[model samples]
Target: MLHIVNKSPQERPSLDACLRIAESGSILLIEDAVYAAVKGSASAGKLAEAAKKHRIYVLLPDVEARAIADRLVDGVTGIDYGGFVDLVADHRACQSWL
Candidate 1:
């Protein structure tokens, strides 16, 4: 499955929802959601834990308006806008976590 996330921990319900998902194979960070990896993001540790535990692929656009794309965490993969589309084409299903 694929997940498109556009919310950070500053938002509550959605953050909780994302943690509860059973299968989010590839997670795409878009818009302001990219801040989840920025320094001091409250959810960074939790998000990292989720990725490791579930083996979920964390994908973020190579260029983000909110955070330094090149500084993405170890488990996160940098992708382009077109790559997001390709991921959906390659997956059987997708869910927008935002």
Candidate 2:
């Protein structure tokens, strides 16, 4: 399963809710949700822990747009638009946390 979140952790609880309910799968952070992948951010530690059970991905373009490319967490992977399409195709299903 692919759990997609596009909200900022600082502004919304969508990421937290998804993390709590998703047991094992992939997580793709798009839009403002890319903020969660930044090092030293409030949600970084939680995201790091989640990475143990879930393959964490962040949209490269989104991260670049936010100018947070250099601060991404250790285990978080960055993907381009094509990679995003591949992820959706690879997963059997996806849930978007709006």
Candidate 3:
């Protein structure tokens, strides 16, 4: 399964909710949710913990747009739109945590 979170952790509980229920799957952070992908942000620890259980990814364009391209957590993979499309195709299902 793939979980897509598009909201900021600081602005909503979407990311938290997604992380709480997420198991051994994949998580793709897009839009404002990319803020949580930062290396030392508030959700950094939680994201790092989640990475141990699930594959974590962030939209490369979003990270660049937000100007945090260089601060991504160590294990979070940055992907482009084509990669996002590939992920959707690779997974059996996708749940968007808006």
Candidate 4:
């Protein structure tokens, strides 16, 4: 299943939602959600680690806005805008956390 989130790691249980539902082949992170990818974000790292440990396919974008786009850690695949839209379309269900 695909879960496209666009919130920072600390707001309104976005991380909690991810932890509760993310499984193998789950897609995560979008827009502001990418903040979690930055270093020093515990929930983000934990989520990524858990996804990897479970072989879940976690994805994020590489666009830079408020900060440089290099904050996303290893293991999370970065896709282009078209791919992102395709992912959202292919996923079917969506829970907007932004």
Candidate 5:
């Protein structure tokens, strides 16, 4: 399963809710949710912990657009649009947290 979150953790509980419920799978942070992938953000620790059980990814373009590409959390992989497509194709199912 793939869990996709596009909201900022600072502004929404969608990321927290998804993390709590998703046991094991992949997580792709897109749009403002890329903020959660930053090195020292409030959700950084939680995201790091989640990375143990989930394959954590942030959309590279989104991170770059936000100008925080250099500060991404250590374990979170950065992906491009093509990588995003491949993730959706690789997973059997996907849930986008609103």
Candidate 6:
């Protein structure tokens, strides 16, 4: 499965909610949710935990737009739109954690 989180972890619990329910699948952070990929951000700890069981990914455009592309968390993979499409195609389904 593919889990997409687009909300800021600072403003909403959607990321946490998604992480809790996500299994050994993939978590894609886009829009404001990309902030969670920053190594020392408030939500980084939760992301780290999520990484233990799931493959974590961050939208490259989002991360670069936020200017944190170079500081992404150790295990988070940064992907482009093409990569996003590939992920969606690779997974059987997707869940959007708005």
What lDDT tens digits, residue by residue, belong to model 4 across residues 2-92?
Answer: 6677776766577567666766556567766666667667666676676664322334333466463666566666677777677778775
Please report how far candidate 3 places residue 27 from its true position, in Å.
0.1
* C-alpha positional error of residue 73 in candidate 3 after TM-score superposition, expressed in Å: 1.1
Question: Please, what is the whole-model Cα lDDT of each candidate in the order they appear?
Answer: 0.65, 0.96, 0.94, 0.62, 0.95, 0.91
Q: What is the TM-score of each candidate against the true structure?
A: 0.77, 0.98, 0.97, 0.71, 0.98, 0.96
Error of 6 at 23 (Å): 2.1
Q: Write the per-residue lDDT of candidate 2 for residues 1-98, one digit (tens) a residue.
A: 99999999999999999999997999999999999998998998999899999999999999999999999999988999999999999999999999
Regions more than 4 Å wrong, model 4: 53-62
lDDT of 3 by residue, 3-97 (tens): 99999999999999998887789999999999998877899999999999999999999999999998888999989999999999999999999
Q: Write the per-residue lDDT of candidate 5 for residues 1-98, one digit (tens) a residue.
A: 99999999999999999999997999999999999998888999999999999999999989989999989989988899999999999999999999
- lDDT of model 4 at position 83: 70
Give the per-residue Cα lDDT of candidate 3 at 36: 95
Q: Where in model 6 is the C-alpha error above 4 Å?
A: none
Q: How would the candidate models be sorted by TM-score, starting from the highest?
A: 2, 5, 3, 6, 1, 4
Deviation from native of the Cα of residue 38 in model 3, angstroms: 0.9
State candidate 5's TM-score.
0.98
lDDT of candidate 1 over 41-94, digit per residue (tens): 676677788777543343454345544765665566667767778888988887
User: Which residue window of length 10 is worst by lDDT in model 6?
Assistant: 15-24
**Among all candidates shown, the one with the greatest lDDT:** 2
Model 2 ranges with Cα > 4 A deviation: none
Q: Please estimate how well model 4 matches the true structure, expressed as its whole-model Cα lDDT.
A: 0.62
Task: Give me the runs in candidate 1 sitting further than 4 Å from their true place.
Answer: 54-63
TM-score of 3: 0.97
